[model samples]
Target chain A: MFGPFRLTNPLSGGLLWKIPWRLSRHQKYRQRERLRKVDSIVATLDTALARQGESMRKLVRWKAEMPTEEEMLPKDKYTVFDRKVKRYRKAIHKLPKWTRVSQRLNPPGF
Target chain B: MPYFRITLMRSGIGLPEKTQGVLKALGLRKRMTTVYHPVTSSVAGQIMRIKELVDVKEVGTALNKKQMREARRPAPGYYVERRGTAELEPPQ
Candidate 1:
């Protein structure tokens, strides 16, 4: 036989006591996450720059050894040949202006 | 609170009048019309009412009415940096 000192409903408010604490901890967790993202971005950018420098060096060596397009491509009789040449000339004409604008908008290493 | 992105995937034709009414209430005049609304129990309940006819997803913020309308518009693809001053100014 058991003696009951107090009577209470099985459902109680204590179940949700940690909700506010969890909410504030989650907020702190999000802040820490944002800072971690910024740190990762900086590290990634540094590694990217290093890779770009190495690639540029290889590009310079390849350009010195590569044959010119005129030397590589043979002139054969084809229906679209004339049209291709005209398009190539037009592209070459626009190249200077394109280079100038591209340089201004997106500088080297960007 | 976040916003909900609701897009009508299917039509409410031949369904019950109440279901069609819910679609009309959502301002979905036609298929593939996207609308943004703040996430609330009432809105959620309305979506549930016609859940079969639409797709729903939660977004960070609800777009303004004009922006929501513009969201469905196609891109112009080209821009004019300069135009004739006479054309820009209205004729006297």
Candidate 2:
């Protein structure tokens, strides 16, 4: 039943209101790029400190904890290992500040 | 002493108050604002807390506010070949 008083296209309905469970290909690509950028920044800091014959323990731990971009599998890159989710995993983009924060590592054997 | 050159790259909007407080403690009030502190365990811990939002580098020396500002300032496009009119030779 088309309402005579309404002036709207049905196609416009639900066009942009959905939050997809999974990320788009473009989002995945960008996420990977962001991870690499963070990595390089850390490496730069490390090398700079190395030149000064000093280092931070936290940086050393971070390097050991997180996997590099090349080290990550596509599955792990697009999704993070989570224990609470039904299948023990969730899309990385589901996390808050996903683009701005680093969440590359998961608990052991998750 | 070596220093940590920390530059805030992301806004702390929607984050926890404690996190925002850390940003303030580091003197990072706005995005792209940089502050330098001597490289120490305490400063490193502060950095670890907000690593996701900053770009850090270690330098041999720390830069004060004025030095950092001067470093960012661009070279003057025009120089005085002869001093300005007020200081120029009088009526000659």
Per-residue accuracy of model 1 over B1-92 as CA lDDT, tens digit each: 46667888777777678888988998888899888776555665576566546667667777877987798799899998887886789778
Q: What's the TM for model 2? A: 0.74
Q: Write model 2 residue lDDT over A11-55, tens digit each, in one string.
A: 457565456899999998888888887787778666766675668
Model 1 misses residue A105 by how many Å?
A: 61
Point out where model 1 deviates above 4 Å.
Answer: A1-110, B80-92
Judging by lDDT against the true structure, name the best candidate: 2
Off-target runs (Cα >4 Å) in candidate 2 are: A1-17, A83-86, B74-76, B84-92
TM-scores for chain B, listed for all candidates: 0.70, 0.78
Encode model 2's per-residue lDDT on B1-92: one tens digit a residue: 77788999889998889899999999999999989888666777787778778988877888888998899899999887875766775875
Cα error of candidate 2 at position A22, Å: 1.7
Residue A67 in candidate 1, Cα distance off native in Å: 66
The candidate 1 chain B region of ten consecutive residues with least summed lDDT is B39-48
